[model samples]
Target chain A: MKAFQSVAVIGLGSMGLGMARSLMRGGHEVRGCDLARDALEKLAAAGGSAFNTPAAAAHDADVVVVVVVNAAQTRAVLFGPDGAAEAMKPGSVIISSATMSPVEAQEFAARAGEHGVLYLDAPISGGSARADAGELTVMASGSPEAFSAAQPALDAMAQTVYSLGEDVGVGSSFKIVNQLLAGVHIAAACEAITFAKRLGLDISKVFEVISKSAGNSWMFENRIPHVLEGDYAPHSAVAIFTKDLGIVSELGRKQSFPLPVASAALQLFLMTEAAGMGQDDDSSVARLLAQIAGLELPGMERSN
Target chain B: MKAFQSVAVIGLGSMGLGMARSLMRGGHEVRGCDLARDALEKLAAAGGSAFNTPAAAAHDADVVVVVVVNAAQTRAVLFGPDGAAEAMKPGSVIISSATMSPVEAQEFAARAGEHGVLYLDAPISGGSARADAGELTVMASGSPEAFSAAQPALDAMAQTVYSLGEDVGVGSSFKIVNQLLAGVHIAAACEAITFAKRLGLDISKVFEVISKSAGNSWMFENRIPHVLEGDYAPHSAVAIFTKDLGIVSELGRKQSFPLPVASAALQLFLMTEAAGMGQDDDSSVARLLAQIAGLELPGMERSN
Candidate 1:
């Protein structure tokens, strides 16, 4: 028999909303909370109940899924005024799904443990589409009891849940390492494409050639199409890297690890954000490079 | 009809030796030369004629493929004392396959043109294995006459020959862009894996996850196994990226293009080289990071 528990989903953004629907699809009762009334309405239309705040949603929930942006937002959702943790049942599991530092995850886990709540450090990847399909890859670490408590919700929302270690912070560490590479690859892709344009090579042909060449990366293959078509629409925004690579930079500083490559990528993201393309597609780092070089990329001749 | 030209492969390194054998397979007469007597003997054993000097090999050959190390070696091979260009017929083609700056390529093309020799700025990729199989990727640029002259050799040695532009230097420019991304991705992969080690996650499991995640790169997938196995044998050495990214940095400086990410990668490669692993596999950058962070990567607990 499948024991379907009541789940509270905080933050009804793209990933969060998809995760909430997946939980509902898994036959769990979902109570969702977000600042946007329209997002709440969308959840209601999808047969899930919606509340105005996280605490209201956390009430009576057996597992609370926190899918906010960073450690601060997560802290706000759980411990701010009328925060969910104050209202969450003592034995409920809190699945934290923010891309944050391991130290932050550790701190949060300790705070949650004080309330007799199980905290699972679970950071998700595979993007929004995978979330919709309940196929997100979750890098998670927690106690055996926390994993046991969160297994059903993990099963519903993730295709793969990597039980990284018994410690609460290891998942965040793994996720940061993943983010470090991801940010660097995106920046490298942008640098290559823009540099190709400067060299008078056809950017599209360069893409095709490099896709088959050892120069290719997952980000290069996925993100360069946006450059080829001059699509600046944010499938994933420049600000996203600015945020994620910012966390990477922060962690590197705290750890005293010299992250020359990832830090360079982070600065480029910061530069792209400063140029006012923060909300544009992450590939807009190419646009920034093109702009700086006074070269025109495809479709946007006036951009230079 | 296949034009069976007499092809001289100068500098019969692994790549050159492979091209020599491949030319023989294409029904061309192959004359090879190298400083390494064993390499020359390998060509001789493969039914190709071998010479101790490039000039001797180039004599009476219709196409001279210069598969040398850099612009300086390529210059010496083509125009040094009793050089191949001086020995070759006026109308014969010179396919220069060195990773050089565009300026250097243009200078060589101009020099070759004075001798009535058509020069193709052709830099090869796909490594020794691909070279052995006659499936390398050649990013080439030259005049139409140069293309027409070198097409047989190109067809024999390369699975794909990208005719980047009509100008001689453009091919070098394109190759530099590709190299820039390739080097950065390698360094980024090293940074990521070492960071994963610092995080206390299973490095092999991190590899398995990131290979499927968006963080993956061609270098990451192709090179991390070396780190996992603690094998640092030079499949592609750290020195290769140092040279390549050095060219990229030079090109960026000449063009006033900011390559912060690539430059960061270049520094990491330089650091890895400085640490006395210059001849080791480029994945040795991970070993360097592991050393700095005092973390033990898989397959070597004593390394820490």
Candidate 2:
């Protein structure tokens, strides 16, 4: 394993924190940063140094992983006030693991290049559970040097890192494609289950049958349990897809590609958000659909 | 096994022919009927007797398995001129395996009862390959007597027979739910693949990553190979989803439930049908999408 002696993980959210711990477990000297004090403290207690800002954590690191929310946050973390780019050593790798448009990724990579830093446009999949298990799948694209530089952290955090090619934005493009399908599938799963509920079929039975049938998706298998158990505790929240699919819609518009199915799915996520369940598990879109149809879902009471 | 000595199968389509052969292999005196002479001759060559009409084939049969396309054809096969219902024994079972509304299943069951016959609302999954292998899944609902009478053929035809309940419509309800999801997932797969193409990512590479990642569906796994191979030969035609999702749309409208995602999927199938690829594989919807987006899918010649 190509092992970086010192690695900095900026943004200690669920995915970031898990990744940071995984890197530490892989025997790297890890530094973590996040605005959330609890997240910072948790990593600190786990035998890694914690910093309040990205730059301070990244200052002496051999490799920095930016696992922030989106392109804007990724940019802010690297180029904002007290940003990591200036503090990082020349030739250090920046592994950007945010879901963003290809254009943004390319721009970010070019900016990082200007700072004499190699950038790997890497976007991650698998939920935080996989991240905690150190088995996340990464879609990555960059120069050979960037991949070689990021190898240590990538090996520590990912079970599979798709070496997409030499283009800076290809990873982002792949991730966007994945988000389009994933978001559509989640909404479709919610729609199917609620539609089953509306049809008076046993929702659990529908889940069981569909899981074994041609109807099933990875999202359906993973997310339908939340609907079945009436547990909307967000493993992946409604707002996450709302944001992701919004990116899809924006990209589609720019490309003159009409994504009608994705467009429809986005509307459902938007409706879920509009119903104030944006922070809830995405399966709560089932609840919203049920509400609109005047159908009662298992763990939901009728407000009227 | 509650083994019936004799069985009759109506509508020798791909699914019906496979199921009929499976019953024959199960040691039943299987009789088959179809309007298509080629289908009937194929069954006849396989050692099952073939008849010109449903009644002649069903005459004196202990179980009549109706495996037609939809509710209307199901109704016509059982009760139309020279129908099977009038010719079957009084206590014989009628297994309706078409995808239909719960109301239609119930009405058919009631009519069968009036004819002094038993009815099993058994809708099948697992497609023609499984049907040929006699390993299909059957979502079945009927009286104990009806189940007992149909057991031999069911045992031959299905690996998993989900006994939904005593109610005649329950199996149809489950089936409708499955079709709703299956149709939507297929359309979602097409949309995602085409969207990937629009983004200039290698389609096969996108398929590889997404299949291992979260965006995958059973349909995606099964059907995308057809797209990747540039083979649009109809394993399941675009018209099938057009018809099945039409059922979904009609059911949604009748129940006043908005199946927005399903409606979106239905429109895509409708467009595929409108583009005259109705007889091609359902994945041709991806080709249609590519054409619309001015993208070239593998094996698709530009029409302009």
* TM-score of every model versus the real structure: 0.95, 0.98
Point to the candidate with the largest lDDT. 2
Off by over 4 Å in 2: B1-4
User: In terms of DockQ, which candidate is strongest?
Assistant: 2
Chain B TM-scores of the candidates = 0.96, 0.98
Residues A86-194 of candidate 1: C-alpha lDDT, one tens digit per residue:
8988888999999999999999999998888999999999888899999999999999989999999999999998888789888898888889999999999999899
Clashes per model (N, Cα, C within 3 A) = 0, 0
Off by over 4 Å in 1: A1-3, A299-304, B1-3, B298-304
Two-chain DockQ for each candidate model: 0.77, 0.83
- lDDT (0 to 1) per candidate: 0.90, 0.91
lDDT digits (tens) for residues B166-201 of candidate 2: 999889888888888888888888988988888889
